[model samples]
Target: MGNLKGVALSLLFTSFVLHLPFAESDWFINYHIHVTNDLPLLKSPPNQPNLFLHCKSKNKDLGERGMVKGQDYTWDTKVNFLRTTLFFCKARWVGHKTRSFDAFVTDRDEMPCRHYHNSCMWSVRDDGIYFSKNNATWGNVYPW
Candidate 1:
C-alpha cells in the first residue's frame, strides 16, 4: 500500500512539472502565430473585398476575423510538452477564393523556430500565403 501511494505521488508531481507554462525551454512558451493581410499592393482600396481568417488548435478556437489591406490577426499559445501541439488556419479572400493550411506544425516548425523566440509568422498576400521562420525572408506557402 505504501509503495502504491509513493508511485502515485511521484506520477502526479511529474505531470505537474511537465505541464508548467513557460518552462526553461523556449519550446514550452512564447509561441506567436502572426497572420497578416497584405493584399492589393498598388491600390488604396483592396480589389478582393476583405480578408477573412479563422485560426485554431485542437483545444482552442480563435473565432473568425475580417481584415483589410495591411491588417493583421495574431495570437500566441504555449506548446504542449508532448510536442503534439498544432495550429492551423483558414483564410478567405472575400468574394474571390479561400484556402486552409497548417500554421504551426510541431515537427516542421520546432527546429527553425528554436532560436526564433517569436515563432511562426505567416503573411497573406494577394498572390498567396507566405511563411517566415523568425526571419525577414518569406516564402510562398499556399495559393488561393
Candidate 2:
C-alpha cells in the first residue's frame, strides 16, 4: 500500500510540472483534423497600425508549435507557414493584448467548423486572425 501511494504521488507531480508552462503561455499551435475553412474579419489599413494574429486549436492533444507571445505582426515571420485561415468576428478589432480569440485546426476532409459552428466569437481584441503575408481573405486554411 505504501509503494502504491508513492507511485500515485509521483505521477500527479509529473503531470502538473509538464503542463505548468503551457497553462501560463498566451498561445498554442493547432494540429487537428476538423478545421479547414478560414473566416477573416478585417484587414489592416494599407500600412498603418501594427497587425497581429492569434490562433487556438481545440485539440489540446496536438499542442502548439510556434511563437506563443509577443507578436509584432511581421510578414516574413515563421507563423505564416501554418496555413490555417482563421475566423474573426467584429469584436476582433480590439487587439492582441486580450485573451479572447481562439481557433482549431482541421483538414479539408474533416468537419470544417464543427467545433466553432457557423459563427466565431471575438474577445474585443484582434486575437483571432492568423497574421501572414499571403492572401488577405480568410478562406480555406491549409496546414504548413
Candidate 3:
C-alpha cells in the first residue's frame, strides 16, 4: 500500500506540472475588426440603399447588420491557439451590387494588427472597398 501511494503521488505531480499553462503559448491578446458604411443610405433615385453586412469566422458569426452612412460595426476577438483565425464579410446595397471580402486572417493580419494596436478597419464606399491597419492611410482593396 505504501509503494502504491508513492507511485500515485508521483504520477499526479508530474501531470500537474506538465499541464500548467505557459506564459507565451497561453497568453491572449484582443484584436478588433471594424467595418464602416461610407455609401449613401436609402433616399433618392441616384442614392444607394442601406448597406447590409454579414461577417463570420470559423468560430463566430456576427449576424447580419444594416448600416447607414458613416455607421460602423466592430467586434473583438482573440487569435486562436492554432493561429488559423480568419474572418470574412459580405456586403450588399439593396438596388446596387453585392461584394465579399476577407476581413481578417491570422497569417496576413497578425503582424500588422499587432503593430497597429490590434485593429483592422474597412470602409465600404460607392466605388470600392478600402482597408487600413493604422486607421490613417487607406487604400482601395476591392471594387464593387
Judged by whole-model lDDT over C-alpha atoms, candidate 2 comes out at 0.31
Question: Number of clashing residue pairs in every model?
Answer: 0, 9, 0
Q: 1 or 3: which has the higher lDDT?
A: 3
- In candidate 3, position 121 carries an lDDT of 87
Clashing pairs in 2: 29-64, 34-106, 35-106, 39-87, 56-103, 94-124, 94-125, 95-125, 95-126
Per-residue CA lDDT of model 1 for 12-129, tens digit only, reads 9999887765455755566777888887643445444388899999899999998877777888876676778889989988667799988888767766665677567788887899
Give the CA lDDT, 0 to 100, for residue 18 in model 2. 72
Name the lDDT value of residue 132 in candidate 2.
21
Supply the global lDDT for candidate 1: 0.80
Clashing pairs in 1: none
Question: How does candidate 1 fare on TM-score?
Answer: 0.75
Report residue 57 deviation for candidate 2 (angstroms): 4.9
RMSD of 3: 5.3
Q: Give the range of the ten consecutive residues with the poorest summed lDDT in model 2.
A: 71-80
